[model samples]
Target chain A: MDLAILGAGAVGRSVADLADDYGHRVVALADSTHAAVAEEGIEADAALGRKEAGDPLGSHEPEAVFDAPYDALVEATPTTLGDAEPGFSHVERALADDRHVVLANKGPVAERYDELRELEAASAGSVRFEATVGGAIPVLSTIEDCTPESVTAVRGVLNGTANFILTRMAAEGLDYDHVLAEAQDLGVAEADPTFDVDGTDAALKFVILANVLGGGGFSLADATVDGIQDVPGSALELASEDGRTIRLIGEATREGVRVGPRLVPENGALAVTGTRNIVQIETREAGSLHNSGRGAGGPETATAVLADVGRLD
Target chain B: MDLAILGAGAVGRSVADLADDYGHRVVALADSTHAAVAEEGIEADAALGRKEAGDPLGSHEPEAVFDAPYDALVEATPTTLGDAEPGFSHVERALADDRHVVLANKGPVAERYDELRELEAASAGSVRFEATVGGAIPVLSTIEDCTPESVTAVRGVLNGTANFILTRMAAEGLDYDHVLAEAQDLGVAEADPTFDVDGTDAALKFVILANVLGGGGFSLADATVDGIQDVPGSALELASEDGRTIRLIGEATREGVRVGPRLVPENGALAVTGTRNIVQIETREAGSLHNSGRGAGGPETATAVLADVGRLD
Candidate 1:
């Protein structure tokens, strides 16, 4: 497969770097301002190195990628909320050209699924965004394999930042503020962790899941979300006394999506620690199935995007 | 799709009973001695009702199902080891006639995957055995989606009976024998639970997984097996003091397959309790993925078989 990757961030760069290993060629690579477009394969390592050295990927304008010979357009731009501008528009252009779009971006998928699916219906191209939720966990594919309606619910600790904070709070018996600061110091939490700590991040993933399960009628606003911002160490201590611990759990049934700090059995599958993420899928006949893994990382997220490309092939 | 389901046990009955809901017709349903064959689709409920009443399913002989018109043959017959007899021959017959085979039996898959694949390669029909591993957890599909080469290993508590006994021993601080007796009383373990307790059951599943991941050269003999019989309650207590517990864990990699009692983090995802089964697929890029659910049950296993049938469609 030939690939045209948009965005020169960690995930996009990883996708380009690893595309060859997955038996694909990078026809075009871009990072907003400039693009390295070639009918033949582009040198991913050279382009990435140039970007790392604070230079243009190539002399070509970023728009040149649309004309480049490619089979799939990888959407790895930063996630944006509400209108989900650039990502949605990028997807639009890719599908309009009859090229498959594999997304590592959550914005277009979570916020604009209905419009995106509508656009896809009119185009020869199809859209797949396995990396949107739970990073590389293959959550969406599992539901797809089970057939969407057969799976009744998807619930999990999706936000690595919130989970890290909660897990540390429970393990160290430290207050949320202390752990959040430590997490920030360790690069586990961003300096301004509002989106993650306030449940918006996890809510976005679950909302996307609800969209898939309910067939594209959901967004972040449809969710009832609560994060780990106010979960005190005392609550963890209390739950611990009863052989339970509080984790920021996100659940998405067709009816609704919810994310909040809930008490789970201490030794239960849902109570995963550290930055690990897990999703529990409840099926009518299969009971509950769980998929846990690294929810976010460059190479990890790229594997999901590549997997999507493979499926398109 | 029209299905011919052999073995009128729980899984077979559930498949026939639920095929209509899945938009499939059951053309033939059979037990060892009785058969109900109808090209226009059998009355599942009526056939099952007759089965429950200890009467023949119909006047037709079991061999008559082989002549029935069907899209797929669901092999739910009892699993036999070594040559994996009737089950293997049943699958052989299905594929020989160019009919797809969705298996609930583990014998052929775990013991004769190479020969089975060879048969599939030469036949128009294909073979799928998701129910042979972790029941309805979608373990096989997850590996397939990730591409087996990308999955490094598969490891988990794949057996429900062993897990139930171990969980009981830990929770009640009772000896293995005591827990086993109680489990038998509660019907969690069979009266002759040797297959489960001695790790043969879990080993079969892991061997099948190894076959899938490694491309078909494994059997029960290749696995290094161990069980929970020697795991005393004192050991569980000791592990609990260190925030750990023992579970009968099975792991399958390209290199080998192993099933043994091992210590896992008490609150880890692998330490799922009760009869719930979880399989962790270690991938090259996705990190560790876990799928947990009712690994055994009529409707649950039936869902997997039916899902495979849907895939064939």
Candidate 2:
């Protein structure tokens, strides 16, 4: 398969690196200000080298990628809310041009799910966004493989940064500020860290999952969001004494979506520690399915994009 | 889709009950000695009632199911070792006739994977056995969705019977014998709990998973197996002191497959209690992916079969 990748960030480079092993060819590569296109295949090493050295691979505009002869377009751009511009327009153009899309960006799917679905319905190619939710956990594909309309509810520890802070506080008996500082220093938490600690990240992923499970017309605005910032060390100690642990869990049901710090049995499936993410999907016939893995990271998220690329066939 | 179901056991009945909801027509239904056939669609309720009343659904022979018109055949017979007979021949005949096959039985998959693959290769249709391992967890489908050669190892707590016994022993501070009796009384274990308690069941599942991950030519004999029958309560107590729990874990690598009791951190993903099953797949790019759910039970296994049937399209 020939491909064009938008957003030359960590995830895009990772996908370009691993695409060969998965028997895919990159025909176009684009970043914010640079673009490279080749009829045969883009030289991945040269493009990555130029980007690393703060140079452009070519002088073409980003929109020129849509003209490349490629089967799919991989959108790995950083997410933005509201209009979700550039990312949303990129996906719209790709789908309108009859090209498949594999998305690592959460903005387009979480904010414009119904519109995207309508575009897919009018196009010859489909859109897949496994990387938008649980990284490489195959959460969306698992739902696709099961009986449609079987999923009743989805609940999980969806944010690694928040989970890392909460886990550290519980394990080390430290205050939230201490753990947040440690996590930021270790690059587990972002410099701003507001989206993760304030529960917007988890809420965004949950809204995306809610759309995937056919909970149509759900967005971040529909969810009851609460972060872990107010959680104190004393609460963790009290919960530990009761054989429980606190996790920032996001749950999506037919009725609505919710994100909050909930108590899970210390040894239960939902009480994962460190930077791991776990999603428990409740189905009527298949019972409950739990999937856990690296919730974020360039290579991990890229693997999901490539997996979606492979499924385009 | 039209389906022909073998084995009028619990799984078969459950499949029959749920087939309509999945938009499938059961054209034929067969037990060990009786079979029913209808071109339009079999009446699931009447066939089940007849079987319950100790009467055959029809006068057709078991082999007569193959002659009936159907798109797929569901094999849910009891598993047998060595030849993996009846089930093996049932799958072979279906694939040879160019029909899709969905297996809920482990005998054919674990014992004769290579031959079944060859048959599928030669046939117009395909074979799917998601029901053979991990019940409704979508283990095989998840592997298929990722890079085929990226899987490094697979480790899991695969048996519900042994896990139930182990969990009871640890929680109640009781010995294995006491818990074994309790499980048997609750129908969690069969009258002859040799297969599960002796580790044969878990080993079979691991062998099947190994084949699915492209580690073919493996059978129950290839696995290094050990049962949990002799686990002492003192061992549980000692492990608990270190915040660990004992689980019957089965692992498959390129090297080989093994099943035995191993210590896992009490709060880890693999330390699931009661009858839950968890499989962790280690990959090169995706890192580690963990899936957990019910590994057995008529409805759960039937749900897997139905899911595979949906995939036949």
Candidate 3:
């Protein structure tokens, strides 16, 4: 498959390095500021070298990637919440050109699901966003195999940043602030961590799951969100004494989507530690299914993007 | 789609009840002694009634199902090792007739994977065996979505009967015989439980998983098998003190397939209790993926069969 990657971040670079192993060719590469396009495959090694040396990838504008002949567009741009601009426009343009899309960007899928479906209906291509929810866990594709109507509910620990903080606080008996500082030092938490710490990231993932499971027309505004910022060390100690752990769980059901910190049996499937994520699905016929794995990382998320590319019909 | 069912057991009856909901028309059903065929679709409720009343389901011979016109064949017969007869011949005949096969019987898949693949290559239809391994867990389909080449290894708790016995022994501080008797009384184990207690059941499932993940040409003869029959209660108590639990794990790697009792952290992903099953897959780029669900029961296995039927092109 010929590919055009629409971002130059860690995930985009990882995809470039691994695409060859999956029998894919990178024909275009673009960042917000520059773009590189080739009729044949792009010079992936040179482009990666320039980016690593702190040089601009290319001189062409981002829109120039569309002019290249490619079978699919890999949208790996960083996500932005409301209207999901830039990323949304990139997806619409690609779909309109009869090109399939594999997305690592959460903004377009979670925030503009219904509109994207409209574009898919009008275009010759389709879109897949497995990386938007649970990095390489295959959560969305699992749901696809079972079909949405058979599923009753989906619950999971969707955000690794919040999970890391809570796991540390519970295991080390540290307060939230101390643990947040430690996480930031370890690069597990960002300098501005509101999106993860305040539960917005999990909510966005929950909304995306709901859409994939045939519960479309929902967005972050529809979710009842909560975070783990106010959890006390005393509560963690008490829960530990009782052989339980607290995890920030995001759930989607027919009623609505919700995100909050909940108590789970310490030995149960949902009580994963560190930066791991778990998704538990309830179906009327197949009973309950649980999937867990690394929820965030450059190579892990890019692997999901590659898997989606392989899924294209 | 038109279907031909070749069993009158619990799984077959369950499939009959659920097939309509999946948009399938059952054109034939057969037991060891009798068979039923309807061109338009069988009367599932009536056929089930006759079977429940100890009456023959129909006047036709068991071989009569092959003559019926059908698009796919559902092989739900009991499994036999060694030559894997009757079941093996049944599957061969179906594939030879250019019909797809969905198997609940493990004999053809675990024992004759290479032969079955040859038949599939020469046939116009495909073969799906989701019900042969992890019941309703979708283990095979999950590997299909990720592609077997990218997978490094697959590890899982693939049997319910042995898992139930081990879980009971650990929780109640009872010995193996006592728990085995309890499980038998509760209908969780067969009166003659050698296949499950001796790990043959898990070994069969491991062989099937290995074949589905592209590690074909393997069978029970190639596996290093061990059962939980000799597990002592004192060991469980000691392990509990150290916050660990023992689970009967079946693993399939490029080297070989093996089943044995292994220690897992009590709070880890593999430490599932009761009759539940879990499969963990390791990949080169995607990290580790874990899937868990109900791995047994008539309705659950039938649900997996129905899901496979829905997946047919």
Candidates in order have lDDT scores of 0.90, 0.90, 0.89
Off by over 4 Å in 3: none
Greater-TM-score candidate between 1 and 3: 3
- Across residues B1-313, which tens digit of lDDT does each residue of candidate 1 receive? 9999999998998999888878899999999998999999998889889878988898799989999998899999988999999999999998999989999999999999999999999889989898888888878887876779889998999899999999988998999898899989998899999999999999999999999898989999999999888887889999999999999999999998999999998877788889999988888877887778889999989988888887774
Q: Tell me, what's the RMSD of every candidate?
A: 2.3, 1.7, 2.0
TM-score of 1: 0.93
Q: Give the TM-score of each candidate.
A: 0.93, 0.96, 0.95
**Of the native A-B interface contacts, what share survives in model 3?**
0.74
- Compared with the true structure, the alpha-carbon lDDT of candidate 3 equals 0.89
Every model: iRMSD? 1.9, 1.5, 1.9
For model 3, residues B1-313, the per-residue Cα lDDT tens digits are: 8989998898888888888877889999999999888899889889878978999898789899998999889999999998888999999999999999999999989999999899999999899998998888878876776678878789989988888988888888999999999999999999999999889999999888777766588988989999998888988889999999888999987778999998888777788889999989988777888989999888889988988988787
True contacts kept of each: 0.71, 0.86, 0.74
DockQ of candidates 1 onward, in order? 0.59, 0.73, 0.64
Candidate achieving the largest DockQ:
2
Ranking by TM-score: 2, 3, 1
